[model samples]
Target: MMTSKIIEYANNLIKLTDEEAEQLSNAFKEVNIKKRQFIVQPNFTAKNRYYVLKGTLMAYVVTDEGHNHTITFAIDDWWITDYNSYIFQQPATMFIVALEDTIVLQIDHEKEHDLKKSNHKFETFFRIMAERGLASHQRRIISNLTQSAEERYENYASKYPQIVQRVPQYALASYLGMTTEFLSRIRNKRVAKKS
Candidate 1:
């Protein structure tokens, strides 16, 4: 199955057997979502971590001023969740939405913990995932504090060219913590330089 590939990647890292892989896959439930649909909304509880089998999704926080601050993006083979909510069993502060037609496999909190208890490899996989997530979030924070908006945009473009191509300019601007107009000017400047 599609989710097996994701589990396999972790399995290989933690040396899980085929039986474990089968159990892991069986624990997940698949679902599809249309573009512009919400998977989770702020103030509600987030029950599962969604693994993307296809398409894209994003998590963001919207302020009273109505500005969206993009937290993260999930593409094929990636995972999306409000970790704070999931871990603490609290209401989510972030909104998770589909950017395109999406297919995801989700494992609920209970199943996730059960899997870890059942398989040492699963525990290792989750540990590695958390570490990588922390590292990525740290990079975002450092970049925001140290880099110019244009530089940050450039780095994001370079690092996630696929997302850059797929996401709207406005959304990208929000993720870069800049205005759409400024992002447009940056794009224009790049275009002129290329000319």
Candidate 2:
């Protein structure tokens, strides 16, 4: 079911015949990444977009202050890339790394272009992903600007419970733009509320 994850993702936006699914899946090359490995580094061009088949990958950047900020994470059935760099063929300012030993299906620019040209459904699927990414980023910006820390954490927990389980708390805290100690307090408050 290596392809099943992507096939299912594709079908969510646009229904495809089995034959089309197979064709779309064929564009990917399987890659295995070791824990702590860097997939794409700052100042390098990101060659491919990866679909997570198992384990996790993170996209992050180190600030001038020498602190890492988590930009995004991808788990099973999710997509991960230094997206702006990949799309525009520019050098990446972010890093993409394997958080755990991982399996992924990767597609290069040529293959992606070919796949999209071959199937309108593929084009629609990617368009939807782009639109959703934009919407999610907008919501996150609004949440950070307006929501209290507790409210933000609760909203994220409800929306992406799987991320809370799969990612380290410190990384999640960074992604939430909070201190780890603050996140710890939030977690404690959440536990107290549940009880």
Candidate 3:
């Protein structure tokens, strides 16, 4: 079942032959994460990259001032990892925590490297995923730089209504670079205008 999900995700990007599908499936292992569980934490190597099959997760870093600054979130069908740590096998500087009980398919660094080396299709698929992730981050950076706080909130709410609905207000607020009280005020204003 998990294999099918991973295969389906891959198939959406690039067609996979029976053998390739089997190989890809073999490369990943399933992990179950409880809500609030940490999958990647500071000082440990991020050995695996996770594909969310069932729930929500947030990647964040705790500042010296004891504030958590969200880096990204991954819900169903999304991917999350400390990319620098996973790619370089270095100690992590971020934490990846499940916001809900989650199931994921994870590929470790060595297996992923082997798979990419063994198959061009696998390599292409990974490259495509990486490129898309980079593009999304680029767009997010540009949006943050150019958009006002209220504009950013509006655009995020419009584009990811589901995420807004599912994520905790505090987490979402941090992700938007605003205080929870500020986010609440913005939301209240929006509701008042709508009414």
Candidate 4:
């Protein structure tokens, strides 16, 4: 039942034969995490990629200065992993924590490799997912480099209203590369403009 959501997600991207669907379903196992629980932490190998079934998760890193920099957030139908660690089979530099009580379907690195080897469709599906993730990261990098803080905040809020509404203000501020107080001021300005 947890796998059903993943099957539907895959099917939306590429037509899956009945057998491929069954294979994919079997490859992923369900996991439940409590709020604030960490699914991946620094120095541990990130062996699985998770597909969110419900609730929210955030991936972030703590700097030497003790600042937490949010890398990304995942909600229902989204995938979350430290791709660098997962793909390279190296220890993770990030922490992936559940922002809310969460359920996810996860595929281990070995199992995913086996699935891709077993079918071209599986390989294609993963490749497409990777490409899209890469594009999103590149876009974020460009935006951070070129946009003003207010422009960045406005663009991200407009594009991902759900994330803006669901995530804690501090976490969202970190993700947008702004301080929490600055974000609060920006938000107040927006509210005043609307009023």
Among these predicted structures, which one has the highest lDDT? 4
lDDT of 1: 0.88
Which window of ten consecutive residues has the lowest lDDT sum in model 4? 1-10
For model 3, the stretches where C-alpha displacement exceeds 4 angstroms are: none
RMSD of each: 1.2, 1.4, 0.8, 0.7
Q: Model 4 segments beyond 4 Å from truth?
A: none
Tell me the tens digit of each residue's lDDT in model 1 across 105-149: 988999999999987778888899899889999999999999999
Global lDDT of model 3: 0.95
What TM-score would each prediction reach against the true structure? 0.96, 0.94, 0.98, 0.98
- Which should have the higher TM-score, number 2 or number 4? 4
Angstrom error of the Cα, residue 145, model 4: value is 1.0
lDDT of 4 by residue, 14-47 (tens): 8998888999999999999999999999999999
Q: What tens digits encode model 3's per-residue C-alpha lDDT throughout 92-156? A: 99999999999999999999999999989999999999999999999889988999989989999
* Candidate 1 off by > 4 Å: none
Given candidate 1, what's the lDDT at residue 65? 100
lDDT of 2 by residue, 81-169 (tens): 88888999899999988989999999997889888898788998899988998998899899999998888899999999998988899
